[model samples]
Target: MDRRIFIKNTSLATAALALPKIDPLRSANLAKNNLPKWKGFNLLDFFSPNPKPVSKPTTEDHFRWMRDWGFDFVRIPIAYPYYLSIDRTKNITSEDVYKINPEAVDRIDSLVSMAHKYNMHVSLNLHRAPGYCVNAGFNEPYNLWKDNEAQKAFNFHWAMWAKRYKNVSSKKISFDLLNEPSMREDMNDQLSKRSAVPGEIYRKVAKAAAEAIRKENPRHLVIADGNNVGSTVIPEIIDLNIAQSCRGYNPGIISHYKAPWANKDPDHLPEPKWPGQVGNQYLSRAMLEEYYKPWIELTKKGVGVHCGECGAWNKTPHDVFIAWFSDVLSILSANNIGFALWNFVGDFGVIDSGRADVAYEDWQGHKLDRKLLNLLMKQ
Candidate 1:
């Protein structure tokens, strides 16, 4: 066996979860099946993909791109203020309606339907979720896992979504449980006590979220982006018998390759900017394998995995990104892990930003990254 396969096979056997007392979302999940065929894509940051004011064509063109690109699905990450009342400001005092927004529901349905029109599969993800997220001000509110109310609210978000989309189909749609749940203590005691311990809360939250989403739809693939500090710790996820999934964000390395996000995060993380610091010795293949090991291990053992997002920032050198992507796509396809590039076009646009009417470059001399189309279409 090749080094990658040998190492991953060994790892999967070690990470299997002793059957938990809590019923798994899909009862059949316990029975072995072929790893789900996943050739999906992710669209984020570009449109906020959130409930925020969204342009219809913004999503329309994106769906078109996925079809043309030969990708089978698209995973969407969105932000919602479920903790607050629908007025968009009031903190939920004592109301169930306080937990979700119908507008978010409506808009998201629109996007899902659009994808369905294209015959593309979909995974709707809560990106900058109620209180849990990497963005500084949004650290989860209560003891995320242990708290009854918080778990209820968290579970409600998916339960409600599943109620709406459960009939969509495991073939056409899936729901990621949460985006990059992590253990960051940067919030200076702002988040409530129970949710305070990062690792513990996240685990509890994961179980609850998974159970709830599964409540409404057992077959849909509900993924939990690895619980590392935020996609950096797939190895840790393997320990949890958590499905192998990664957000594929290494700011200075790829997406932030050269754009100016280094100090962008509030003080807690002063991660550097573009072409920032991926070590010179780090060839794309090495990076892909290291990042991919967890997923490879899971799938070989009959556990399904997904690469939720992967794309470089348009600000960085496109050529460098194209070269890196060649290896990343090959690994994902080889392993049968579904992936979504970060966006179609907008801030990190693949089409809309720099090129104006053209599909490639938005600026002079910087032609569109010709490799992008080929990379996505690769089998």
Candidate 2:
């Protein structure tokens, strides 16, 4: 079915409650030295590293629907290999990383243009960068946190993107340097033990990339994802003046209950419950507040903070997902920190999520989670 026709036929009555207006004084303050609290979702058109069959292009209906629903931001998470000319059969080399594919880049350009056409802010993020990816499948030739060659290639890619969009206003677009920077023992093992990159190493890499980006356009805004896979804030690069991105998947037991990538044994895990005991630990809104205290405190120090990726897998019960997510959203919104859900569609989205428990609303042939959509819009 044509998504355009479907969107046109969908009802807007459920979205009538407009998003709360930004406080003028707070807006001015954040505009002066921090990032705006721009709320929206992540679009995964280029999320996969192997681009044999490119992901479906996001249509105009996406942008139109987002704007009409009161969302003003979209984070485009790209796997660097998706845009490079490389062999899928072999490990990616530093030389292969430098190979620029114009056709692949053109596809990205179209998405960015379409996003801006709807007045939505675009944040370009490298979910899979040159030398590292949090959840691994492809083999990386070198470690981004430790190898000079990998760092050089990383800067090279950021510089190329900076130069490409140098003419675009910082207000309309920003660069999220890398997604979920962390250290893992093996690049190709998804189950490898992972830990936070040392502060000095993360700082050095971020500083160099920020310099490369600014070398093209000093006004280009740059953002760095939180350390330890976006769960903790990075104090090391605060002085560099780069905004920081945080994650919303706290208490992984709740967010990734039956997900294979997050859990080694999805079938045997305890069922998730909000404000109740899951396994042995007690979870509640107070726990969530305490979890985000450091993040809120970081903002008080004048650092721009945003939740880059967040949401529960479809396997989580709908009631539990909504109940827990409500506390998550309420806390962030209260602190004036905006968030972008992990996705706009698919297993972790507000539309066509394929959750067996949800009484899905049919919107233009798409299964719309009106409950989830209403919750997001009210924020």
Residue range 1-379, candidate 1, lDDT tens digits: 8999999987886665544556544342333324455665666532242244555244566566567767677777766563233443433232433455565567667777888999888777777554455444433445343457756776777787788877777778777776766544542132322222355566667767777777787775666776653354343234444464665554345556444433343334333323234444434466567776656666666556777777666555555665666667766666566667766655454554452223464333234434476667664
Who wins the TM-score comparison? 2
TM-score of each: 0.71, 0.91
Query: For residues 1-379, could you state the per-residue lDDT of candidate 2 as single tens digits?
Result: 7998777656453355455767886565432227888999999999898776645457899789899999999999999999988887887887999988999999899999999999999999999888888877788889899899999999999999999999999999999999998888887776789889999999999999999999999999999999998989899998998999988899999999889998888899987999899899998999998998888888888899999998999999999999999999988887788999978878899888889999998887789999999989987
Q: Candidate 1's error at 306, in angstroms? A: 1.3
- Cα lDDT listed for each candidate: 0.58, 0.89
Write down the worst ten-residue block by lDDT for model 2: 25-34
lDDT, model 2, position 147: 93
